[model samples]
Target: MEEEITFTVPIRPDMELEVTRVASSVAEAMRLGKDKIDEIKLALIEACLNAFEHSKSKEKKVHIKIKMTDDRLEIIVRDYGVGFDPSKVKEPKIEEKLKSPRKRGWGLKIMRSLMDSVVINSHKGGTKIIMTKRR
Candidate 1:
């Protein structure tokens, strides 16, 4: 059986921690390992932050949906803001990032590295980031 929960909140900085905490609790309830739970928390925060920083949605909100099963967890982060091509975004160089620290581009890379699967769909209308992890 699969269970799902959905929530939407304005793109505010304070909401980031709240969303992360709730998602972490859901992962815990599904009996995912501790390390996996940590990864989920980080990914969720990054996704939300990206929406707030990049998405110029008129509503200024992000929608988060989490689906849980016995063996896996899937999360979708959606934004109504103007979307840009994910392919156009270049991967950050580790060496360059080390020399000068800036905070805008690392979220996607970190999420991909931590999750089992990361799929990004973006068009002029909106962007949806789908991430999944398995036990």
Candidate 2:
């Protein structure tokens, strides 16, 4: 069953729930389990938070697109923000990260862990995080 969904919403925090709903609807359509659903929701929320924090002050919305099939799930989280280099992201050792007093770089790490693949493409136009989870 191959299917796709795409839509955009405001970058404001108020639109967070809308992102979650979009994810949940996709999960249900795919018959995903609770844990898998939660992972998807978390990934979306993290991406949305990033967009809300970093996107252009003049931008009106963030784009989210998802594709699902029997063998895998794919999601694209896009923001019209000043893009950053994903290559510069480095993960702290598990122990160090776990023991650190403050949160940092955890979002990128979490997204990587929960999904089998994550590719971030960012430029002046926008930042798009493409992620996949093999079922």
Can you tell me which runs of candidate 2 are displaced by over 4 Å?
A: 93-102
Residues 1-135 of candidate 1: C-alpha lDDT, one tens digit per residue = 899999998887779888888889898898888999999989888888888989999999999999998889999999988998888888988787778767358888999999999999998888999999996
Error of 2 at 115 (Å): 1.2
User: Tens-digit lDDT track for model 2 on 17-94?
Assistant: 788888888887778888888888887777777777776736768888889889888988898778777777676577
Q: Once model 1 is optimally superposed onto the true structure by TM-score, how far is the C-alpha of residue 118 displaced, in angstroms?
A: 0.6
lDDT of 2: 0.80
Model 1: residues >4 Å from true position, as ranges? 99-103
Model 1: which ten-residue window has the lowest total lDDT? 95-104
